[model samples]
Target: MPKHLNNQSSSVSLTVAAMGVVYGDIGTSPLYALRECFHESHGLPVTPDNVLGILSMIVWSLVLVVTVKYLLFVMKADNEGEGGMLALLALSQQSRPVDLRKGLNVVVTLGLIGVAFLYSDGIITPAISVLSAVEGLTLTTDVFTPYILPLTVALVALLFMIQRRGSGTIGSIFGPIMLLWFVTMALLGLHSLIQTPEVLRAANPLYAIQFLIRHAGVGILVLGSVFLVLTGA
Candidate 1:
């Protein structure tokens, strides 16, 4: 192959691999997020207006939180090609004046708390993703329903075991799996959009603002569920 062609192929391959390892949890959030938004506990009625409102929130949340916040801003703040809470902590300490650095014990405490949150999220995200995926089997038939919990537990345990081999190994194993998942889901979403093209109206920011204003109490609770979409980000 020509060198240019080879380089393009390599770029595409790396993008696919990154999509899996970095984005698998976010991809899987759809399995449960919409359901959680209208779950009985939230007392949200499943009307057309409500559906549009909730979807609008989801659309803007992805836009603002992931696209605008992470991709645009946060990703630009990396230290020496590294990112994450600890790296940011180190960067802050280095940039502060000696006199100001002494007052940064509070910053260190906050950074540690953020690290704990990230660690907790990593453990929780996979479990929820696996459990939600297994629960989808109930839609087809009840046969798998009885075993969902056991299967979820087994799958999560397997994931934990696989992690011991290092992230590179995990990425190599799961990258193609998640790439296939994303492609399958994209196709399904395209088909659904074809059927209900009107749903695209939910892309309007006004719908989200209206949703929160009209249903402030429930909307506040729903915001918690909406954040699920940001899990792997």
Candidate 2:
């Protein structure tokens, strides 16, 4: 291939690999996030209005927080081409003036705290996601209902077992796997939307605002559940 064609191919490959590795969690989260909002602990009703409200909140949260804030803004704040809380902290410290050194210690301390929370999240997110997925098997066979916990554990263990191969190897397959996953999800969502096209009205922000006003305490719980969709992002 020509040099330009080779460069283009490499970029496309990297983009696909990135999709598989980086987007796996966020992509799978939709399986459980909306359902969790109506869990007994949240006390949110399953009424049409409430559902619309929750859906609206989820839509806007992804648009504003993930697309606008993280993709557009935070991704630009990299340290040596790496991005994360620690990278942002290092970049900030480097760009600070000498006069600001007095408070640098405090900033570093806070950054460490954020990193600690991130570690905790990494441990919890996979467990929750796998468990939720395994739970879905119960709908197909009642036998799975009894084995849910064990199956979840085994699947998660196998997932971690493969991690030794390193991210580069995993990422190479992730793009195609995630692409198939998303396409399946989109088709399922479209099928449901066809049955109830009115649900599209949830795109309005007013539904979210009205839901918050009507539900008050329950709204908090719904928002908490909705926040899960953003996890691993």
Candidate 3:
């Protein structure tokens, strides 16, 4: 291939890979995050105000934590060309003051703990994402309801089996699928927005503030739930 075409192809591949691997968790989060906010345990009433408030919280969390914090700040912390908890830990050890060298154990421990959390999330996230999607079949027909667990298990197992093929292969396979899923969701959301344009009012920060003030204790719980928006992003 020509040089410019090669560069374009590489860029496109990276973009697709990011959409598949990075966005997948965050994409599936909407499946259960909003529902969790209004679960019976939360005692959250599904009034229009409450709905708008929750939406506002989710929107802001994504903007601040994912967009601003991760994209702008965290992305800058890469060690050389590498990233992730281990890479940062290595970078920190190299850059630390001589006086702080004695505390290396503590730093290493903290980094290891962060790695453990990532591992746990890796295990839990895939299972939950697949199961939640499979369970949606229940809403369409009762026939699939009974087999939901089995189907989820089989699908998840297939995912793990494919893992041996490596990230590049997985990305090439999953990228277009996730891309289509996101595009479909965007269209659906746009259709809904066209019908209820007032929902856009949730974009204001005041609704989130008002929600916290009115709900008080419950608002804190909902805030934790809203943090789910940052899962994959």
RMSD of each: 2.4, 2.7, 2.5
Deviation from native of the Cα of residue 88 in model 2, angstroms: 1.3
**Residue-wise C-alpha lDDT for candidate 3, range 1-233, written one tens digit per residue:** 99999999999989998888778789879987888799898998899999999999999999998889888998999999899998998898796633554655777889989999889878877887888789888887899988999999999999999989998888888888899999999999999999999999999999999999999998999998887666776
List, residue by residue over 122-155, the lDDT tens digit for candidate 2: 9989999999998998887898788899989998
TM-score per candidate, chains pooled: 0.91, 0.89, 0.89
| Residue 161, candidate 3: alpha-carbon lDDT | 96
Model 1: residue 225 alpha-carbon error in angstroms? 0.5
Instruction: Give the lowest summed-lDDT range of ten residues in model 2.
Output: 95-104
User: Which candidate's TM-score is highest?
Assistant: 1
lDDT of each: 0.88, 0.87, 0.88
lDDT at residue 79 of model 1 (Cα atoms): 85
User: In order, how many clashes per candidate?
Assistant: 0, 1, 0
Candidate 2: the clashing residue pairs are 20-174
